[model samples]
Target chain A: MIMDDYKFLFKVVLVGNAGVGKTCLVRRFTQGLFPPGQGATIGVDFMIKTVDVGSEKVKLQIWDTAGQERFRSITQSYYRSAHALILVYDISCQPTFDCLPDWLREIEEYASSKVLRVLVGNKIDREDREIPTVVGEEFAERHNMYFLETSAKESDNVERLFMQIAEDLMKQARSRDLPRYDSNTTTIDGKTSTISDFSCCSK
Target chain B: MHFEIMDYELPTNFDVVVVGTGIIESIISAAASRIGKTVLHVDSNNFYGGLSSSFNLESFLKLNIEKRKSICMEHSSLNDTETFFPINNSDFTLDEVTHQWNITNKNKNYSDEENSAQEDIIAKEICAKKWLKDDLLKESRKFNIDLTPKVQYARGDFIELLISSNIARYSEYRSITRVLTWFNNTLEVVPCSRSDIFANNKISIIEKRILMKFFTSLDDNEDLIIKDYASKTYKCFLTDKKLSKNLIHYILYAISNSTDSTLCLEGIGNTKKFLKSLGRFGKTPFLYSMFGSGDLPQEFCRLSAVFGSVFALDQPIHGLILEENSFKSILIGKQKIKAKNFVLGLNLTPDFFLNKVKKKFISRGVFITNKSIMDSDNEPLTLLLYPAENDKNPCTVLELPWLSSCCPKDTYLVHISCNQINNPEDDLKHCVKNLFTLNEDFKAFKPLIFYSSYFSIPTNSDENVNLHDFNNLFICPGPDSELDFVTAVSKAKELFLKMYPDDEFLPRAPDPEEIKWDGDEEPSDIAQ
Candidate 1:
């Protein structure tokens, strides 16, 4: 069996108020294009982007909210197993930024305690921005989360946001700070072995 | 900051409105949304799964307290042409709930020499820590205690549907490492695979050869042999084959996973299913979803959301309006949402719709134990089927280790379920006593229960319920007393077909890499 060539795989989930450019940030970072009038995301589950962290390649599986955030119905399973959570808000929208505490409450409730949280204030290119950069920075500082400002329309800071997350997670993996990936192993008689060696009806 | 209330009104129209987030309703929602039908999936409970949700220890206890409060049914006036049926959101399915912590809050003290010995053992092996009740309560969120726990056969209908529909990507699973059986007052591992049969030391060589021959014979059509035993019981067929009593016990209780009175054809079918699913993932034929079985339904809901289905949890439906025997719309608070079709869970269905349908109860017990029932060097995900003894029915036991993400480290989540003869504790007390130690000092080797909960879930066993009054309304049954979810998947398919006979059921959803974003001139390729 051929395995994907990556030293580490991290699941980074995106959550915030709806229409806050969460999808746009993901599309800009993974697809390298800003989809204007990106209607409710359909047929898209998650995006995978492999990047080089130092000498090793790290794969980032980026999952979108799929419009579930609109109704606050995101399943708790969505937060399970996530290595990082990127909480996005629209800079020009006050409600989206004001709802950050609600989003943080959800994160504190559902996400793993060790999960890395990053606060991204999106739509920096909009002229009538309600939230200043300092305000966002102070909020992120209060929450002890990594802070950044990104304009998905102009494709500014989007790449840097994801790269920084990948580098940090890659460093954690190298240092054994994160949980070891044990999805493919089955233990028998105290011995851990990969399941690829076994097949049904081999007899 | 200004306290502003965001607009909470949902769209008033939909192609399909599903009333529950159970496995069947979620599957139907995904199927309908997969084919471009606008869907609105709602659950009165804040959690995703209605009766199938998994809860942490804190919420599980809180839910029991809340379920005890009784609410009178509210009457609503209806027009002359319309009849109103109020929706019952109370957890009527779960009854006789009880949980207790056996261990105290204080940690066990050790002498200096004993402390050094404990440290050596911890350093040498990943053994379970002597957890006090305070530690368990503090880390209660790590536990994913399921209300209706289930396992999946590697080649079963649910697995096939998951792979076929591409919903498998959203979830993770751990293969059940061992299948055990309690026989002759002893717990033993059931040899399920070819390697296991050859490696067995308990059975004689002749018994092993006979078991192997019996299994090999199932591969052949054997139409004549099947016909000869079609009218007889499986035990009678095994006796006629001249197998030893030990082999018969293993075949009937462990492999076939049936009672003594199981028909020959049904028993053979079950055995073949077991044989067919072996080695697909591991030695055992079963795979349990990581976290809990409640995560399974949420995975389908995620697929549905990806396909443009609107979901709103904690949204209660006030009542359902039926106009001249046909389903019309539902009342949510002060809002009326209309849909062309409606699918409701059995608990949400009115009494008139479920008249004459006999309800069967499945007694369930969830226990957090200090060790595995059958100790091994490594923590193993175990499935044990204790055969019926005397008046007790056959019980299914699933012991999930922490690696399966069902419980915290150093503890195992043990679930025992059987047909309800009385209350949950009474129905499963015999099996629980045989497997675990309720008191700390009784059985030295047996696992000690720290926390345990017992409850009974109501399910409709009779299939012939008269549902012909409303063409667009469908009622999905709750989880049955089955080891696997083959029945739930089939029920979902049946309901989907009844609603949309021409629409295709959930087809293969495109992977994230396959979805081409607009404005990209080049084909989007994944960076794997």
Candidate 2:
């Protein structure tokens, strides 16, 4: 396999309501800069980012699903093959926070049973936050998901969120004693894994 | 499990109100929304795809058992397979499907007659154990059976639409591993690509040269060969080429994929389509979805939502407010949602408009078989065209080996579709017997049919792309009984342009990372 050097190629999907900063969270984490006033994502778009996890090169194929009620089927289709599901909601919007249960329900239906999950509260830089950090943490705890708050606008916890997902995916793969995904042609949740040279982690 | 009831209210006004989430309506919804139109897409069923959906094994079985109110269905067995199994609608719900193996006792008998247990045929050569009904029921969720079985011509409109709309990223496709033709009472792989033709040992060296010459003639159509047989049938055209009977059969059934009565022009056109489609993605000229065909409609629906199109499933438009040959508003349950343009699936077309339109039914059968029709080392995604037998029409069979994730491991999901002739069973039974075994023929080299269902789907035959009052309301036809999406895409494109004459149709949507987040700087003219 050409991607033998990379320790893991994880397919992580981001799903939430519209205007919840799902795209912003992906942008800030992968690009280190968040563009404000981003428009709605049409369909599901993805990006490739390689991160360092304890000297292991982990490439993340992050799928950013459009956060609209109409796209539930499309987003749910991605869930079945995902290694990790990042359920994001805006911290400043009450409706987005309230919709976490729906998102969790989606994960229950479409996601693989062994998929690692993370709850993200995005747009935390906004001062007028409607949902508290405790509220998000409690909800995540109830669903048995790892929780974190991020400000894609300020780039706070954005990097940590993805790094933790990569690390956790590796940890989960190890604990389950599942075969390591080193094959360049291996499909994680049906999407082809990308093989690359020295990752950005080395840089 | 059901989704948490989403408290979504319909937008009071929308640029387009699309009902029925079939491929056609879904594409129109996405195309309209891609251009920034306020779109409201809804389906009567709880799921995304109304007719062209991929259901899990249980749901698919239940759909076959449970009678659909909106869509008409009829099936019956004839000739040798006279036994009929009727699904009592009350026995099963939409979510759960039930089936028990009736051959466990037969296993003991067959094995007792030979060496050991031999009821299950698929597991004999591959493994030591036999597959039981419980094994299939346990892994039912893995199956994604399409209601309308179809494949994408590698370069067909559907593929072009997916790539152009940037929705192709949402799904994955594997090229059909082989194109098989039913010949000499067995299936033989057709040499499609140039490499396959050159390497196929089945054709003699002399025959290979003749086939290659014919293929090269079909390459660009610059030769005067087709013009000479312009008015004759494609069969005549092939005979004029001095090709052998085997070569002629391969050309008619596999290459051109047209009927014997097909004109020389249309036959050559189909041959060109087939030839041009090869090697675009792989050795075969077809691409089957890695998941299932239903993923396509959902991708389009996703594109619509990315543009902020409001979507609601299980919401049926009960009435339409028509004023002077134009629709003003639609009544969904209790809410009145107004839209400038209304696009609806033919099955869901308001009876007022559909009063005069003729309806045609496409015969379909979904079977979960234990082995591939033509077993090979790697499970193949195969497309088999069984020529019309007796009174039945030509049947197109699609085999999604377990690797396609449309069925459980060690099981192949086969869908047989054709133009309805009286009953679906009669129309498809001959073809089913050709590829699979119905009775307990232990040694016959045919895929064992674990379970099967037959139904007929009603589609509009109207080639008059527009309805009489289509100025404001457009009716998109349900799936036609074709192996490709050329008809559906052209239909969707025509409807889209009628709704938005000035805007680019499904312009390429750029990746989100390609667009800068610079405030006040509008994203490029890429499909927003």
Candidate 3:
């Protein structure tokens, strides 16, 4: 596949409590179907989907936690290279929402300071919503993150949540503020040089 | 909210269960999981790499200071047919760990000195002021100090395995820019390629011509000449070639990466390997992981996890159940996990199992300095092989700058490793003194060590034939004293083949766009 087909590629990582519908939101947006009985994602690393932002095609690589969040044993390497982190919480469960601070502390410690963060309150279709919209909005404002409420079951606001991230990242890329995208070239003593003569697939 | 342990239940049965997350065990785990094995990889420590883990400055110092307490296991629960092997976790692998700070707590001002000392080029350029220990402590999180630091040949087995298995996507790397050696009590770059040899002005025209002729002779397929000296020492062969001392030193130490007593055949092979790997990545044939060598194991673990392996860290293994000399299951905090086979790190093996195997040791020293060992306009990743002198074993030194993300800006992380003849400090003190200074009244050229640590890691000798008596148990040794992961990769492949003879080892994993869901129509079109 030719990489230049996309105007920009962004790595968007989803992290939160185990059952906070993080996987459901990703499947709903990427596969266009909310998987039923998605028990602890297995054998699936990440999903890629292409979206349009202002007549440009942008590819999003969304990485799931793979149930590592169950024990809070997520690897630190997972957060280092992420361009954007989407922190999700279950609106119906107060405990998942209460764990937001814990996850934010991890982001502060592991993720880059300039990484784009978005606060997502998932599972909003349930009637017993313990966290109101205003509460999550306040938390996002306090943490300087973008806020959105999504319901994977009803397929509500999932597309817009991802589209907004892609657009914002594209704007950053156009302004030359986003991290340089996976170029093998390195600058040494004011000279830009390509370090590798062979690509990744070459022997 | 305070962190609480959740009731996450793991499956009781697995096709394979691996107990340490070192490079070998991790590679085996990834290989097993890649070929559709239900693998559960665990480590007693909270980190991904067991003995190979990297730590920040604070954690690294804390580990050196604290003594670990061993956990007790209860054997009363085992039945008559079951035998239990308790894992000893208390014995810390690192010995004689010594860490100290040379710089004081106060930061010095260099503004006044920078204007007056124009002729003192080295000191003025490097900023004459020393950084306070408090400053390093404040930026402690930026440091990724590795207990075991290694580099990979661009065309070596490890890089080939990574590329073939497609696990290289998880991490990044920077090439080693220069290769240096200690000759005449000074540091000098070893020219490996044609361009380097031509650009070097230190060697005479006649010496360069002789070196070029010797290298070109090696490039030709001369199997008869190589075989004639197979049983002889490499030094004898170099002497027979009538090469100068400077040329022999460069070939024996830096290019061939061998000791004086290395077999002629092995030395020639190493030289061929080194020459073949050049220009594949950069000026040198080596590539270091972006963060540290410690990041390598975690990348394999990530690949294992991606292929459906269950990963658990900070979880203690209470005991292993053996039935009629075959492994059956393991106990972890009232949970029993059964598996068809078990792969464990050498450190995790029971004392009874390892009674017959001899243990070896590697001396290591880690230091944080204010400047690079060899000054340059741009920060470069350097590899130095200090050959044996005065009854000392050859030392492998890697100096990493902040651009590699192993340390903070304007600081370098220096790692010295060698085979243990004595304690770490005694084994490495000579080389450290040559490269750095611990005193406040240090030379302007030598880098000052703000912090230094010396320790020894116990490794298992290759005499592990006794461990094969058990039909289903495999023990993996820790990192050896090699500069690459060639041995570790081959060992992992060997163990993997023994376990699954029919399955391919670490087949290339498809990229994200290549994977198709069950009911996907044509691949998603972007222009919809």
Worst ten in a row by lDDT for model 1 chain B = B519-528
RMSD of each: 4.3, 9.7, 4.3
Per-residue lDDT, model 2, residue A101, is: 85
Q: Which stretches of candidate 1 lie over 4 Å from their true place?
A: A1-5, A36-40, A185-203, B1-7, B68-80, B108-128, B356-358, B462-464, B519-528
Per-chain TM-score (chain B), model 3: 0.93
Question: For each candidate, what TM-score against the reference?
Answer: 0.92, 0.82, 0.92
Residue-wise lDDT of candidate 2 within A89-192, one digit each (tens)? 88877877887787777677667667888989987788788898999999999889999998887778888888888888888777864332222211113132
| lDDT-superior candidate, 1 or 2 | 1
Best-performing candidate as measured by lDDT: 1
Candidate 3 on B148-261: residue-level lDDT in tens? 888998788998888888787777788899999999999999997777888888888888999877776774546776678868988788889999899899999889988899
Clashing pairs in 2: A81-A189
Q: Report every candidate's CA lDDT.
A: 0.82, 0.72, 0.82
Q: 1 or 3: which has the higher DockQ?
A: 1
Model 2: CA > 4 A from native: A1-9, A16-50, A54-61, A70-75, A88-105, A120-144, A149-157, A170-203, B1-6, B64-129, B219-227, B355-358, B439-443, B464-466, B520-528
* Candidate 3 segments whose C-alpha is farther than 4 A from its true place: A1-3, A36-42, A174-176, A179-203, B1-5, B65-67, B109-125, B128-130, B219-222, B356-358, B441-443, B520-528
Docking quality tier of model 2: incorrect
**lDDT, candidate 3, A83-151, per-residue tens:** 899999988888888889999988877677778999999888888888999999999999999999999
**Clash tally, candidates in order:** 0, 1, 0
